[model samples]
Target: VTFLCLPPVSFLLLPHALALWACTRSCPSRCTCTQEKSCSVLCDRINMADLPKEFPCEASSINLDKNNLKFLSERAFGTLPSLKSLSLDHNNISFITPGAFKGLPNLVELKMAHNEYIRYLHTRTFTSLKRLVRLDLSDCNLFSMPDRIFIEQTALKELLCFQNNFRRVPGAIRGMENLTHVYLERNRIEAVAYNSLLGLTSLKYLNLQENRINVIHDEAFKDLQQLENFYLNDNLLAELPKQAFKGLSRLKMLNLGGNLLTNVSKTWFSDLVELEVLYLDRNQLCFIEEGAFENLTSLITLHLNSNNLTALPFSVFQPIYFIGRLYLFRNPWECDCSLEWLKEWMENYKLVRDIPCASPSSVAGLDLSEVVYARLNGTCVDPAELNLTTALPDNPTTENKFNILISKLLQQELKEDLVNSTESFRNGTLLDPAESQVSGGYNGFSTGRALLVLLSMYLIQAETGPH
Candidate 1:
């Protein structure tokens, strides 16, 4: 026999060429096949009305998304023991027989999202996919699932079920201990009852935003000890139980924006010591009790903008040591003596946004930084002239007395600095209006005086009550 001469690259590609030729011969009509580490078939958007009757046995992945397939018969994909991934998203599939996915033992991912006609599924639909790690069934108009639907998928890790008609969290997810992420946003969920999420110990992220959730049981999330990120924004929550978030110690970020909360209670977050970012914006909050965030020592960013707050007591945020970003804009701030501590605090915490005055028309619309002591109707007492020792009661506590003296000393120095700055501004020695608005304006200020007046009004309130 004549010896065939071939290059080294051709020799290496010979096996792949033979595999591709075999896959092409077995590939069904209107489909393409290629040889990678394994065979992959692309039959997406083919306008097919049924699953292809023939597929290469060696095919490890298939994409049939955006097709007209409306029904899935039993054993739809016949005994593809090597199939690892399948995408049937954006199809018109409305019915799935019990054993439709019976032969996909090694399949790790199954995406059938956007099949809006599918509202119910048989309990044994996915019973054979024991090794499936990710499942996407979102936008299927599903209202509920059988209690034992996911009882066998112990290896499932992520579940995406957003934009559905579910009235509550599916009870089928109660025992998914290996699940790490769940997306249930934009659903019709009305409440989160206790034990609704009973045994998901490995969960790290949960999204329930844009739901109708108005109530959360006290221990609803007590089992999620490892959860780190939670989103509950744009809900109808008017209030939460005091112990609603009791056991979530590792949570780092919480979003409660766009809710109906009228006040914030201190007990709601007493155990969240590792929390770093908090979003409480766009609510109906008019009051926040003292020490509301005392346990959040690691808090870094806080959002209190777009609320109904007229004034906030300074003690609510005194415990957060690492706070860096504070958003306090778009609220009805009453610029009075009780708000003097806020002005003093914002002067040092330069990362704070501009807080405009809403009452006492003289300072209305003016930033808190621009409102001088003289404009507060002379309500704030000059610390240099006030006697701290005489202001105290007959038998004052040591902590109270120490805090009063420190507040007096701080106010005295701040008053003197303000007087000198005002005099310089009048004498044309300070920066111009444009320069001041850019350099030492509301967005930019010096540090080191943030804690100066932290406990001033709080301690005073304890002795003399609100100013």
Candidate 2:
């Protein structure tokens, strides 16, 4: 070999030049690499049919998104021991051989979303990813998964499997106690069986929205005691068991919009004392029994819009003290004396949407806020004065007769109180004591006493009704 002489400065730069050469050689053609902190390779949208033969040994992240890759061979990426993240989104990958991710012991996240052709995965495809914290398999055509595929992923916390063809919640996630979030929206699931979500005790957020689910077993979510936000909107649920939500004590936000629910029951929410925001819009609801929402003491936002409601009992919303937003638009409201209390309540909470009248031709198409009280010509006849033997429904069930009696009694009591208050005001006996030194302060006090009596009677009647 011929001897070569160089400036002294060349020796000082030699190590860096060698390193640059090695980096360049390791980086595949049409791919970009950054050496900051550690190597991060980007091979997105390269139209490649296979993974590059070589990648930097120190690579911490690799992006192979939007490529033509169809298969992942065994030990395909085993050389990148330091890899922490790998993204293969928007590929046509349909198969992943076992041991393909074997050597990546430190991998923390893997995104394989939008791989539409991937209908199945090998049982051991992710067996070595013990430290994985997130795995996104969304937008795949997957209908099922092996039950033990995720047995070794002890540290996984979030799983995104939305937009798939699954007919139910995957049984593979049953024993994943560390899992906190699971997104299974936009699937073809038809129901939630009791064992579907049995063992995920640590789950906090669960999204089953936009599915075809129509039935839910009473104990389907009994294991999710820690769940905070639960989404079941846009399903086909027409009814639920009395204890359908019994174990969700810590739940906050609940979405039940876009369903076929026709009525609301008090026992359905007996255990949801901590619930805050509730969505019941876009349903077929026409009736909500008195005290239906009495247990929702922490409720803040309520959605009842886009339903078939004609009237609602004021007592239904009396227990919720923190209510701020109330959605009541797009409903066929009868702007009668029954809804006068709603107007008064709306004035106190201006966030409530305007109610549009659908009956009583005079107020038809008019906003409830603009209708004068005199326009509400609906009358509430006192049931105590009527001949119950003739006025009551013939051949009625005990439950039906009890419900009718309670409704008429409540209406009569409300009407009498309103009439008394109006008469006192007109007679100058209802003036504020501090402003006018009125000697009839007793009148105002009597009104309060009457309300308490009415509430007590209602509660007593409710307690004695059918279970």
Candidate 3:
């Protein structure tokens, strides 16, 4: 009976062994395959024009980076039925066929960054990645985004398209219900449309920094019920759309620094009941409307440094209830009668001690916390003669030149003050004795220069006589 073992069973074993040996030798230099219930393949930088048709990747992850692959055919990736994660970063991939991600249903993360040749992604290219949570398309040289680029990526939670070349935020992106974080910074967007952000109800953090956005529509952010952090810094915006941030009920931080705004009213932030931190530094704002921030009761930090403001309204700080710090330096705040309101408010507020001016001549080194507003009314007065007028040509020009020169001289002085502030805060001397030296040196030099220029002009007039 042992000698009679069936020849048919023995004949089938020969071909099975040969088939297994063929798969192993197909790409001995680039891929590895191991049989453990299901075969898996590992290929790093294969640089093939197309995926190997016979590669058995039933349960595997493929990494193909730093390759010269320029296009992906429609069914190229569909063959990798079990690929869970794909890394095609740093490739020269320029074109992807429609429905490129159709076969990648189990993909969790897809990184396509640094592929500078890819400019536009078709609407349904990523529709098959229903389980994808992280999609990084940053630095891809994308100049314009299609309206339906995210139409089918319903499960997407994080989308990073930073450092692209979009001149305007695309009309697409209206329906990402589960998206939590979106990074669109460092682009060329000039205007944001209202319909562009209509249906994103679960967004929490959105970064729009370093763009060229000049206008933001009022209804652009209407339904964001859970938004917390929004960044719009480093743009060319001259003004906000009055109700630009109307419906961000859960917003906590907003950055509007590095813009061209010249003024803002208290009502501008009246609806942000939950806003905490606001950055308004480095703008052309000459004034803040008296009640512009009255509604931001939850605000903790306010930055208003490096502006062209001449005075602060009397009731500017009346609405803030819990401000931990207020930055009012680096602006041309005239220490005059018009600034009495700010002086009074600072006297009543406990956190008014940290306000330091970039120019000693501008803020006079008065510790706003120690100086009573009533006393400051008489002490920090600017005489009527200092009032600028067009008729005072030589004087105004000379005065401006003096200010510019002295501003440059005191550049390092301001940095030293900021440094000392940290050291003093640590040593229990938040305000040290050296603060008293802020005055006299800078102010006297400016005043004496103006007087000397005025006297010299008079002498020149006497010698030259009337024109």
| Backbone clashes in model 1 | 0
Candidate 3 has its poorest 10 consecutive residues by lDDT at 383-392
- The digit string of per-residue lDDT tens for model 1 on 111-130 reads 99999999998999997999
Over 1-467, each residue of candidate 3 has an lDDT whose tens digit, in order, gives 24243234455575554434434554335667654434445665667555555554454556666667788778666555666667778888888888776777788888888899999788767767878888888889999878877776788898888999988766666778898998899988888888767778999999999999988887788877789999999999998877778767689999999999988866567678898999999999987777788888899999988889766756775677688888877776555555656656677765554443222243455443333221211353332221121112233344454453344334434445565552323255333233533533433233334554566676557557899
How close is every model to the real structure, measured as TM-score? 0.78, 0.76, 0.67
Q: Give the Cα error of residue 7 in candidate 3, in Å.
A: 29
Identify the leading candidate in terms of TM-score: 1
TM-score of 3: 0.67
What would the TM-score be for candidate 2 when compared with the true structure?
Answer: 0.76
* Candidate maximizing lDDT: 1
After superposition on all C-alphas, the RMSD of every candidate to the true structure, in Å, is 13.2, 14.9, 15.5
Pairs clashing within candidate 2: none
Q: Give the TM-score of candidate 1.
A: 0.78
